[model samples]
Target: MPVSSATSTAESPPAAVPSATVPHSWEYDGTEPFPEKEPAAPRDRGERLYVAVTAAIVLAPFLALGLAGWLLWGRLIHPADIVLALVLYTVTGLGVTVGFHRGLTHGGYRAVRPVRIALAVAGSMSFQGDVIGWVATHRRHHAFTDRPGDPHSPYRYGTHLRGQLRGLLHAHVGWLFRNSRTSAARYAPDLLADRDIRAVSRAFPALCLLTLALPFGLGWAIGGTLVHALTALLWAGLVRIALLHHVTWSVNSLCHVIGDRPFRTRRHDRATNLWPLALLSFGESWHNLHHADPTSARHGVDRGQLDPSAAVIGLLERLGWVSDVRWPTPDRVAARRV
Candidate 1:
């Protein structure tokens, strides 16, 4: 439930620095050292099967967009469908941003047992992968960042224009199909050991089904027609998932390559703060600040920067649902500023 900041030396990369503030279980022992060559893509049947399933997950909703657009043209969409879509999008999006990312991955604050489990469940419904795996992959990303060991860095190709273009595509979505796996045992041992979190991770497939079924059930109840249920599934289920998926992925692809870096990060780490994505990403577009100080509960520390995730954390803190929030201090922010 608690993790603190990691320490780094000028010679040591961020990945090698373990947290001094957390117990052994909570500590991220950083993945293998940076500058290691990327693993060769495995060509086994298992890898093929993994890619096939990933294609279904990533492409099915995208194909649904075409159907949804056709339905919209025919005036088949109900306002109830739009409203339901918005509601589910907000819930699942925040679940990924606040729940999977800030709370579970970085340990920005300590939530009560119920809140913690609830957030994990919510994030799981976003179709992002289970809680433990998601946290483990993200921790591995922070460890290696843009270096060779990093899983989804845009710099994986090169700094050249053509390479950057290819990398943007890879970073945005191609990385999901890769068979390179982050070890939950090494990176997220704490979550692996926790009975509650393990249970949530085990329930990821059920949550995926439930995420879609809820909209269908609600639409059936509201509109009382089979057509209504199907439309709701299209709009509120598939379309919403696609929108949130790209937005979250844009943080990995666009945020790194195309935004302002107001905060300094480790060498080769080019994470940036893209303000246009602030609202949609629930303040996670402040990627530069996050790379600078991963443990900070709030990323939009500067004035006029909107961070809805931070607001939620603040509200939870006020209600005593969470505690030990690592809100950025003035000195801390100033020190990291470019």
Candidate 2:
């Protein structure tokens, strides 16, 4: 196969940083040594709900799956839970891959208004931060991977065992609570300029509710019982989120620390391809290839690597929902192979 001519703008020179003109008092890129004003304390009902939901998801799977077994308890685990979990995981995971990372961040292909908005909404259900913030942080990660400025690098701390453990923890989830946030103004000016994306960002809380409620509603209607609804909410909403969180976080922590570096990338960038997570991560575990070629659309470029996200993008393209698809060629991939 040959590399497609539809490569994205990521291969071009960096965009101008209009954020440099932002009001100084309000700027919070988390890079300044001392900001004049701190990011305002978390307020709003939505903020509180976000915190609580995140906590529940992180703790629920353990009690439902592990602690209950320890006490010889049963009931929390339902067959329907597993089925819903897999189904929701597939939908929301692709939301992050095809929607947030590839479509928004990398511009691997172009989507029409309806398709773009749908992607954003579906990804919002994943309960990751809004699109602008996610893209900003990710772009920052690419700007400075495994270096001082990478938002979620596992190597943030030194290589000592204690440091590595601490770094892993930070990369996995601790970084979310950090005072410093990636500036969407600096990194995602394209998204910030889009009124539709801004509106989608504002609707994230409602989208979260929709994500949780849809599965539970379907379960109640299908199973005709409150227990069934609860189980669906438990598995598809909370447990599924936890599973997605760790897998996405693993790409941040584990992909950098472990796996095979079969492709070369920026000097000092530690990204590697972790095969164990290929299917679960929807091909994003091909971190080495992704880091080597950021806008290729397909991360798992090798034969039999199984990139479902790429396949989805392909389907969408053929359906006329996406255009300028960037399919990789053997020559392009061969150039990056170590």
Query: Highest lDDT, which number?
Result: 1
Residues 8-72 of candidate 2: C-alpha lDDT, one tens digit per residue: 22343334324443453543332232212344786668767656765665666545545434433
Clashing pairs in 1: none
What tens-digit string does per-residue lDDT give for candidate 1 at 262-297? 999987788999999999999999999999998898
lDDT of 1 at 58: 96
Give me the displacement of residue 318 in model 1, in angstroms.
0.9
Off by over 4 Å in 1: 4-42
Q: In terms of TM-score, which candidate is strongest?
A: 1
For each candidate, how many residue pairs have backbone atoms clashing (under 3 Å)? 0, 1
Candidate 2 lDDT (Cα, 0 to 1): 0.77
| Alpha-carbon deviation at 206 in model 2, angstroms | 0.8
User: How does candidate 2 fare on TM-score?
Assistant: 0.82
- The list of candidate 2 runs beyond 4 A from truth reads 1-79
